[model samples]
Target: MALESLDRSPPPFFRVGFAPLTKLFFFSALSVLLMFGDKQLQFTKPIRAGLSTLIMPVQWLVLQPGQVASSVGDYFQNLDQAQKDLQALQLKQLQQSARAQQVEQLLIENQNLRQLLDLKNTVATPSQVAEILFDVPDPYNQRIVIDKGQTKEVVLGSPVIDAGGVIGQVTRVYPLTAEVTLLTDRDQSIPVMNSRTGARNISSGNIMSGTPLIELKFVPASADVKEGDLLTTSGIDGVYPAGLQVARISHIERRVDISFARIHATPLAELKGRHVLVLQPTGIQAASKGKAP
Candidate 1:
């Protein structure tokens, strides 16, 4: 009987206030009433707002590391893409610059060809256009090689002229090429007539000057030679045509010690031209359709 009177359960601290099912039903009803009152009246609105405000900074702090990582990744990706774009643009600009240079060079070549064609029409002699291949490698002579030769009916001693005047005379002929000796060459000479005074003289390349030079040989000091005199081919050599420009008297040195006057002339032709006209030698003008004799 005494044992039955003693409590057998745990202490009140461990005891539940209500059964589990009973607590569930009571909390459900209370939650429904609180929700209805919160929606209808404004009793818990300030408390909820205060709780959200208190939690906002914590939520932001929790998301900050992920946001920062995402921004860093985006920054690197944009930088890489920008660098690639810059490189591509630079390459394109270089290609455009090369193309522009090619176009400019082509335009210059076209202008030169047009000038050559115009010069071809002024002379009554049969002529053909020839391209200068390269300069002769001999340093002792001022000579050039042309593309036309025996195969093209390029005759020996044919006079070559550019847009300006006489440049050279064909010296050697091959099957497909020819060599031209310039007027300034050491062994080349031409018969020139002064247009101002009609005086005939022999002009030859000056051997005394190491540079290319043309001077009237053995002209008497009392002759009518003067500076800035225009000289043309006299056509006496039967090689060059008559009245073609050859040179201009640039300087004249009259010395009392010598009987002959020293006269230097500047060549009228452009020596560095790319194209020239090859004219039939005046001696063979009666030939058949400009064919070599």
Candidate 2:
């Protein structure tokens, strides 16, 4: 009896109306029916539109930063691409301009060569085309290596001429390569004859004076030499073939202090190109059939 009098009933808080699973099933079924009705009858269209309109501002606000970031990224990418394109165009323009200048130079060279044809036949110095390898790394002497050597019948002390004029002489020889000392070297000297006046003088490189510095020495103050006179090889030196184009007198200054006139000349050869011609000195035999250009 005392145990029965003690309250055996659960607290009101524990009182249950329906099980959780039962409530879930019932709500699920109701939701399905509502969805079917909304789909088939358009019953919820107005409601959904109203809810969407109410939340649109919030959605846009949340995504605004990402949209702005995407736009900024695209802007930067386009700007970088434009800069690269501009740089490429500038490089292309420079290359075309260089090619145009080269073409013009080649045309002028062609015309001069045509005029020198008779002179070439008169000298009859057979020559072979050679390509320059690289300049010697010395700062004092202007020397370059060439692809032709003893193997190619390129003789030592042979004159190296280009389309325009004499460039250098082959001083050192190897089986497959040779070294050429340009006329501008301080130690170099060439015997030149004036094309206009037939005056014979020794042309020596004065590397200290000016660009491509060369000067005629021992020319008498009263020598029949004048500015703008073309000089050719005098053939006095057995090493160089006779009548090869050499240098032109740029200026002549007479000094009473010295007997020789200070005659400065510029080289006729545009020695900057890779193409060159090497001729075997008159007595030395060549292996390949040659042409004068």
lDDT, candidates in the order shown? 0.89, 0.84
Instruction: Using lDDT, give the best candidate's number.
Output: 1
Worst lDDT run of 10 residues, candidate 1, spans 284-293
Say which candidate scores most in TM-score.
1
Per-prediction tally of clashes = 0, 0
Rate residue 187 of model 2 by lDDT.
Answer: 83
Task: Put down candidate 1 lDDT per residue, 244-293, tens digits, no spaces.
Answer: 89999988999999999989998889754478899999888855546854
**228-248 in candidate 2: lDDT tens per residue?**
899999988777877888998
lDDT of 1: 0.89
Candidates in order, TM-scores: namely 0.69, 0.66
Cα displacement (angstroms), candidate 2, residue 16, comes to 11
